[model samples]
Target: MTNERRVLVHPDADALVAAVSARFLTKLTDLLDEHHEANVVLTGGTLGEAVQKAVATSPMRSAIDWTRVHFWWGDERFVPKDDPDRNEVQAREALLQHLPTAEDHIHPFPASDEIEDIDAAAEAYAQELRDHADPALRLPVPRFDITFLGVGPDGHIASLFPEHGVTRDGQDLVVSDEDSPKPPPRRLSLTLPVINSSQRIWMVLAGTEKASALGLALAGASPEEVPVAGAEGRLRTVFFIDGDAASHVPADLIASQY
Candidate 1:
């Protein structure tokens, strides 16, 4: 991982989305150039959806082969697949519906109805990763080329909320979080260990309310207190902040060399 935190500040949310979209496309193109496929972990939120929309509408959208790109979500609401609140549903409407990607490439968490047992559903997703990865791999998890994440006002990422047991649990790549501050109460989230396994991770923030949380995360707060602070990718980790969300970060802090 790099020593410096890569923070990109934009004039507004629209500009932020454009910058993030370009970065996302560059990362995807790099992954495809090095490997035959690209695996991306998506998130659910306004900023996240904006990035997806950017990708869908970008002029370079056609440069990559959508068919070979694999999509996964960082977390999901434990709702029926067709529920309007489901992240998958929102993502499809925002971007996937526009992409030429194959159905098999889109892997969403199991719907509550699909698997009666939430724990079993999480385990099933873990097994799916194992099946796709080589046995000799130490991590035993798929190396995501890019993981797009959104931070909650409480400084949570994915479904890993502050002081939640799932935030510290190290075994499962996917786990059911039962005490999320935000509801539906129950959710499936990628553990911090799994999130750190990605080659690149990007945390996107847009609203003014997120400014305080962004400052705390940048200050290196503990994940137990602010879960977003724990994100660390092997190759790179970036924070894409709009002016509104970066207002609380001190000018000197941002000017410091790492």
Candidate 2:
């Protein structure tokens, strides 16, 4: 774990998406060159869709054997599988559906109807993560090659809202938020510890609304107060932000070269 952090600023959201999508494919290609399999965690939102759509359309999408790459989500809404609000649904429509990935390789958290409750859904996903972990290492969760995330205007990452108990919780690999600050309250999310376990954490931010949140995260605010601040990847932490979102970023914190 190098624990290196980088801030990449793009001129606009479109550019940010393009850059990220290309890097996503290129990095996956590099990882596949070194390993037989790789694990990638996805995110949900307009930004997520943009990135997925970019990757889906790019010719570079074929750079790696999609079947060998396992897809997981950092967080998911506690809704039915087909619900428009579900992260898995959006991801499938924008990208996964187009890829030749194996059915078992795409891991989506249990839907509301598929499970009795959010707690059960969290446990189910936790078990799923454990199932894919290296038995010899005895890990509770598999090592994520890359985990993509989005930060809320309020500085929340995934469903771990600011000041929420889930943000402060460290015991669980996966946690539920029944009272999220944002609408559509119910959600299941990987905890900060689990997120930090990833080899690379790519945080995509867009719009002026994210300016303050990015500042607080870069300022090192407490995770309970700004959960986005807690997302430090084992090897690298990257903030792929548009100029609007980068407005509040300190000059020194910005990485001159990626």
How far in Å is the alpha carbon of 56 misplaced in model 2? 0.5
Which regions of candidate 1 deviate over 4 angstroms?
1-4, 134-137, 166-169, 252-258
- Give the CA lDDT, 0 to 100, for residue 63 in model 2: 76
The model with the greatest lDDT is: 2
Clashes of 2: 0
For residues 105-157, what per-residue lDDT tens digits would candidate 2 score against the true structure? 99999999899678988999999999898543324788799999999998888
Best by TM-score: 2
Give lDDT: candidate 2, residue 153. Answer: 95
Q: What does candidate 1 score on TM?
A: 0.93
Task: Give the TM-scores of the predictions, in the order they appear.
Answer: 0.93, 0.96
For candidate 1, the per-residue lDDT at 238 reads: 83
Cα distance off (Å), candidate 2, residue 152: 0.6
| Residue 250 lDDT in candidate 1 | 72
